[model samples]
Target: MSATGTYNKLVPEPTPHSAPYWEGLNRRKLLLQKCRGCGRIRHYPQPMCPSCHSMEVEWVEASGRGVIHSWTITHHAFHPGVREDLPYTLATVDLEEGVRMLAQLRGVPDDKLRIGLPVRVEFETVKDGLTLPYLVPGEPA
Candidate 1:
């Protein structure tokens, strides 16, 4: 705890540009930006697609299915908010849309964190002010 009473938690806030993405999260669904021009998918929702540099972008619903590209086992929790979640696995998953995302892994052992592990989306309230979409180990390869 800080003297200022700030928890320094991992809370996510939705901005005017990204509110829809967070809104979709509340519904337990995934949303990504797709280029209306080139049909390319984007992860960090931008005003334009990175490929064709076109401003014609639209929000497309995703399957929320992906595979673990990489992961890290957090043995120590430096922040007070994350202390309760110690030893949790943080994973970077590659979605079928070709976009990579970082999410917390659940329902799996930390020793099992491996590359190319199949994963699925799992939504939960990660903090007081936010409900985030996490990832859980999917079917075995």
Candidate 2:
């Protein structure tokens, strides 16, 4: 960790195709790629739409609401930088936009976590100029 309370964990390297996604998170907003050809939204931005194989795309803000599709309690940290966050929950969430996102689950207790549990996105700045999204229990907005 740095003096700014930023974690030492590895951060994402933004590419031309995914720059807007990272930029949105830095601005405390969630953004996903919307395929112009198929009118379907997708996460982890790419140059082409997977469904229609079209290069035309646009950026759209996500609602930041989703439900727990699956999760696991991590007793061990794969990276030394995240050792302090051991015993955390990593969840696979099914977003309201029909895309599945994987993020760290926080604020919700283990006993309270279950499939279909509603969650909302919360942004956390882990480093200068970088913010990541996490999930917390809440009603969809």
Candidate 3:
């Protein structure tokens, strides 16, 4: 959110387990942690798998394709940093890799919003060395 080192928006702080995910986003790729023990993919990276309680983990590139499971339009800003971007859409997307991710939904009008609509991830560089993913209407290529 800060382009000149004065932005006030909160940014993600990567930890040891989540560093790869942040790094992948910087490279414009969406990555998820896959459990080696059970092959279940997960978001919000962690050291252990929730399904199998496995410590074995691997990073895999996600397809970046998903469907809108649900969404809500924010009519008010919860923080001062996002006040200017009022009336934004927050969507819950079910990725093809079997993980659900929540992110800002953009490039679509409110009247056009619907459940089960196709979407894809796109990166936006808010500042140097920092990029984030958001969803937009589209089908996987």
Error of 2 at 103 (Å): 1.0
TM-score per model over all chains = 0.85, 0.92, 0.92
Candidate 2 Cα errors over 4 Å, as ranges: 1-6
What is candidate 3's lDDT per residue for 47-115, written digit by digit as tens? 988889998999999989999999999988788888877889999999999889999999999998888
Query: Judged by lDDT, which candidate is best?
Result: 3
Q: List the residue pairs that clash in candidate 3.
A: none
User: Per-model C-alpha lDDT, please?
Assistant: 0.79, 0.88, 0.89
* RMSD (Å) of each candidate, 1 decimal: 4.1, 1.8, 1.7
Output the lDDT of residue 34, model 3.
Answer: 92
- Per-residue CA lDDT of model 2 for 1-141, tens digit only, reads 243865678878899998998999989999989999999898778898878999899888888999999999999889988898888899999999989899999899889988999999999877888888898897845
Which candidate comes out best when scored by TM-score? 2
